[model samples]
Target chain A: QTASPAVAKPSRLGLCASCHGETGMAVMPGAPNLAGQRLDYLRQALKDYRDGRRDAPVMRAAIGPIGAAELDALARWYSAQAPAAASAP
Target chain B: QTASPAVAKPSRLGLCASCHGETGMAVMPGAPNLAGQRLDYLRQALKDYRDGRRDAPVMRAAIGPIGAAELDALARWYSAQAPAAASAP
Candidate 1:
């Protein structure tokens, strides 16, 4: 197999960029880093936050107005970024 | 506020403890550590893996037969563990 091309940065990052950073390496404390996360997991999480299945007020507010396609784009963007190294041995 | 008491370990961890560790710190490569993750996120992820909403053959096989309450207990157990430090600056 070959390496995949870089994912495009979504135009509608909105509040997601504030906490999750432009590259999805969370800029805020307590915000989970999104870089290199599973695309499906990220997609589901955004939906959960938007629809209140996740029960996080801040995340819900951040994602409330976002639609499904935009959410999928965001998930792809984040999932393509390089994740920081693991902290544990 | 008082410190929360330790969460009890679920006996039905099954293959979870093999890759995710007894304490959720991920003993296997490519597996994300689960310690100190949000309880809701962990809960949702488990359901996702089991239901095929998030596709990972290993995870699906590991969690396929697990029930809701057992999954919740597992989530609580992992969420209560101390996370390793962040790898990023």
Candidate 2:
């Protein structure tokens, strides 16, 4: 069997993968795809969700306990992922 | 009557304001608050929706006919808006 790719998942990604897939393609309707997004934008979004600057109960609950450094790491991971192709309509 | 602040609306913002408010605060559930999001990120999102890189039927239909320069203008307008305070939970 061929060896699988060794992509290390960011530890702080916690529950984000449930909706935003491991590589940042959104798995559910209404969740924005996060792959290949700007790092700073992702950082800001995480911060916003955690700090109550953006209001989304599910997001707040998921990211609330995460710290600034951890948030940055999560942002970096999602931003670095390859953007998936458009889903079949 | 008191003169309201002279915020110029971007012409290309067409149907976006119906959901993503004129100032980018989302008006409906499931629509993300876009106020103060990164200009480049917003521009990229608009392009992705228009070009089918990101698949959302509503976003695709809304932005498909818009041009690049117009999309950029809409991004600039939304990114410049003040981020709204988080809604009461």
Candidate with top DockQ is 1
A1-89: candidate 2 lDDT, tens digit per residue: 11113335678665887877777666665466566555655777777777776555678778867877778778777766654333211
Error of 2 at B21 (Å): 0.7
Q: Candidate 1 — which pairs collide? A: none
Cα lDDT of model 1 by residue, A1-89, tens digit: 11125666688875687977776656665576665555656777777778766555677677777888898999887767664433111
Structural similarity to truth (TM-score) of each candidate: 0.52, 0.49
Which stretches of model 2 miss by more than 4 angstroms? Answer: A1-89, B1-7
**DockQ, cand. 1:** 0.08
List model 2 lDDT by residue over B1-89, tens digit each.
11113335777665888977777666665466565555555776787778776565677777767887788778777756654333210
* CAPRI quality of model 2: incorrect
Tens digit of lDDT per residue, candidate 1, span B1-75? 111256766888657879777766566665666665556667777877787766666886788778888999998
Candidate 1 CA-lDDT value: 0.66
What TM-score would candidate 2 get against the native? 0.49
Listed per candidate, the RMSD to the true structure in angstroms reads 9.5, 14.2
